[model samples]
Target: MLTEKQVVELLETIYDPFLKKTFKETGAIQEVKINKEKGLVSVKIALAKTGTAEQLQVQQTVVQRLKDAGASSVGLRFAQLPFEEERTTNEPIYLAIASGKGGVGKSTVSVNLAVSLARLGKKVGLIDADIYGFSVPDMMGITERPVVRGEKIIPVERFGVKVISMGFFVEDNSPVIWRGPMLGKMLKNFFDEVEWGELDYLLLDLPPGTGDVALDVHTMLPTSKEIIVTTPHPTAAFVAARAGAMAVRTNHEVVGVIENMSYFESKTTGEKEYIFGKGGGQKLAEELQTDLLGQLPLGQPDWNDEDFAPSIYGEDHPIGKVYMDIAKKIIAKLR
Candidate 1:
């Protein structure tokens, strides 16, 4: 006879497409009943939606995995995601930095942009919504965790910007294994549980791709705006358009698109190198009916090692000037 625990271990292999997580991680498995004599197993799962292709796939996977676990037959049922009213806020201007695919330096743009806004004497709060691949802490050189007081969390302050990320909660370089529902809950806590004082801007460094977390933000923050980041590579622009389309579909105002790594400048000869190609940002903006906010150069910033901060160029640095200009435009739009 298969034990309930064994059945659970087998079902853990099944992943939800939207959540990008296992049933076990999402706490979707509400119950597991087994009939030892009959060698039958029954499972109840929590899902965001029912009777969909993905959900049907999950159900089929459960049946096969359970049968492989020695059950003669298996029964599965799904319960919709528990409905809850998440806290809502309309005080600060919420800006989400999003990308169609990962590894285009979205987080780097987020960290620097937030810092740039703060540099202009604006109170900024940044949320690292990329739970699975969180790197904001390391990029900002944040070693300390968020301090808890009563039921609220105090965000860590760095370079004049207040920051909170999954990096502060989990072990260094550890993975965040959670389901879609959990991701929504965690995002809500960032607004409800964290004591974010008055701010001019609350920036969310969204995860790559149009996943559950991004959907949660879209649904939760109706007034929030978005900034799409993409590389100069044409293929990258194609993918980034999906992200921009999602923003439009969600009815979130797209502040603009920032073209990263548009070109590399030769130090000695002062010649421009379009290493990743050019016009991707402009193409994306035209597709989305928006403007290309700014084009960023590929280079490293000069940082003070004693602070252990990422390469955030000051207003004097060329890259820093670009960010400052973008931040000013965003401020103008918000105000």
Candidate 2:
């Protein structure tokens, strides 16, 4: 069992996310209770803000730290502190990669664009906002999970990009059965509680269509710029326009459109095969009143068992160069 004084000392190291001050400095640890017989510790804390994702992070940290310090159980309560102006941090340029329907390679576009920007020496962070269809972690070959330090969840870094995904939280590829409100809360937590550090760009890989998760992201990031993904097929591009329309409705700038699986290039004859048809990308771009970012062909990345990122393209790969060009266009447009 731990003493009340010991608990206080432990908690003093934790800081209030909004206030940016330790519990000791802020005098935010209102009460501490310890039960020796039960080896239980209970604490009541106040922060500059409550009922936020930051509060939940602080609660988790307190519970985990007490348990690690030999407490069998821990309980925490939170209240809002007296008024103080919350500190502000530099916000990154928000970019959301969305598609009207799945199987159009939206996630593929997102991962590649994020990696390409990172390759250009830009600080980038990726949020796998497709809670129900999260795949960024596996696509980026990330084998590690984010760790909690103090009160913030540190994002996992790979290919020079920092990333957080719903895939990390679920076990054994379990389906996320959460409702809309719950999913929205988790998305908010990703933005508010994750320690993204300094980032030039933060990319969101949204779920397909105008779903709840997509709506939540639009509401959360009103200033975000979006890139719609579609196929060269006319129907695919037509459906993709709906996503672009939603972005427009939410006041998000439609930066461009990317037509994926545009064509396959034969290795033997080096001929271009328009498998998904053509001109859909230009039509969509024209309708959206934005530039055609790039067209990606149907192809697989050269697999390397050693590094082993199934969906990522090497910088020197032909398709990878196309992504780099699109990334450069994005930088120029956004800047």
Candidate 3:
């Protein structure tokens, strides 16, 4: 027969798969009582959530480990812990890549940053939360819907980064009319349904400006920060500033700013040209009191250029170097 202390020692070695913590560390083992005379040992355990296979497996493993550790008989049961349902605060930093204007290359920045992060050997995920104009599938060259396993939806993976987008669900030529509660529920499903596992960063590509979708994200991911994108054109910067300020109001920290279409490099002349005025990026960052992270050129206007694929799937292109620099700045700012 085993004492409660000995049983607990063995139980401590069993870890919760999802939470990535040992039972003992998570306070899952509430108490251990060994009724030596009755030849039974009972464990009161707390689970992170209801009906998670991983949690149930941890419970079963605890029972076996306790019995194997010398308990004559074992019983394991669980109750929910109120606060454990939130994603581990230890999980990777989440950054929302948003723009105040459409056609500013926000999705492109999100996709490239995700790729750049993965190239640095960090596990990364990109969530295309822009329901109205989802573009991740085209940007990533993915055509398949996510795989469904048990209760978890596995994001589509390519070039070492995992991606999930509404583009995978709705019609190609058609637009989604999801509104109100339905929209919120569908977006929330991405959190609960997707098996993100562990990641170093998860970038959400939000649609332009203050809108219903942006509001939903702020509410759901209260800790997520924002990175506003803008162009060098003054008015665009003015509008982009509103976005940064809105993020501040929502308690989402503005990590920095990105200026897309800041300049164009003449392919033939090989000279930098600010086709769209100037100073918008720096001006926006200055007003927001944040870093002017980087400027992305209007490189090869058609992303479908045969050369672009190599950049994503292969090692590095000159454009890849630019994105890598921005990725470095982003990681530094987040830290």
Alpha-carbon lDDT, every model: 0.86, 0.91, 0.80
Q: Write the per-residue lDDT of candidate 3 for residues 206-248, one digit (tens) a residue.
A: 9898888788999978999899999999999988888898898
Q: How good is model 3 by TM-score?
A: 0.75
Question: Judged by lDDT relative to the true structure, which candidate is superior, 1 or 2?
Answer: 2
**Residue by residue across 70-189, what tens digits does model 2's lDDT show?**
999988889878654333434589999999899999999999999999999999999999999999999989999999986689999999999999999989999999889999999989
lDDT of 3 at 126: 87
Q: After superposition, how far is residue 268 of candidate 2 from its true place, in Å?
A: 1.7
Return the TM-score for each candidate structure.
0.73, 0.78, 0.75
Q: Model 3 — which ten-residue stretch has the worst lDDT? A: 306-315
Q: Rank candidates, lDDT, best first.
A: 2, 1, 3
The best candidate in terms of lDDT: 2
Residue pairs of candidate 2 with colliding backbone atoms: none
Q: Point out the higher-scoring one by TM-score: 1 or 3.
A: 3
TM-score of 1: 0.73
Q: Candidate 2 overall Cα lDDT vs. reference? A: 0.91
**What is residue 285's positional error in candidate 1, in angstroms?**
0.6
State which candidate, 2 or 3, has the greater TM-score: 2
* lDDT computed for candidate 3: 0.80
| lDDT at 96, model 3 | 93
Q: List the pairs of residues colliding in candidate 1.
A: none
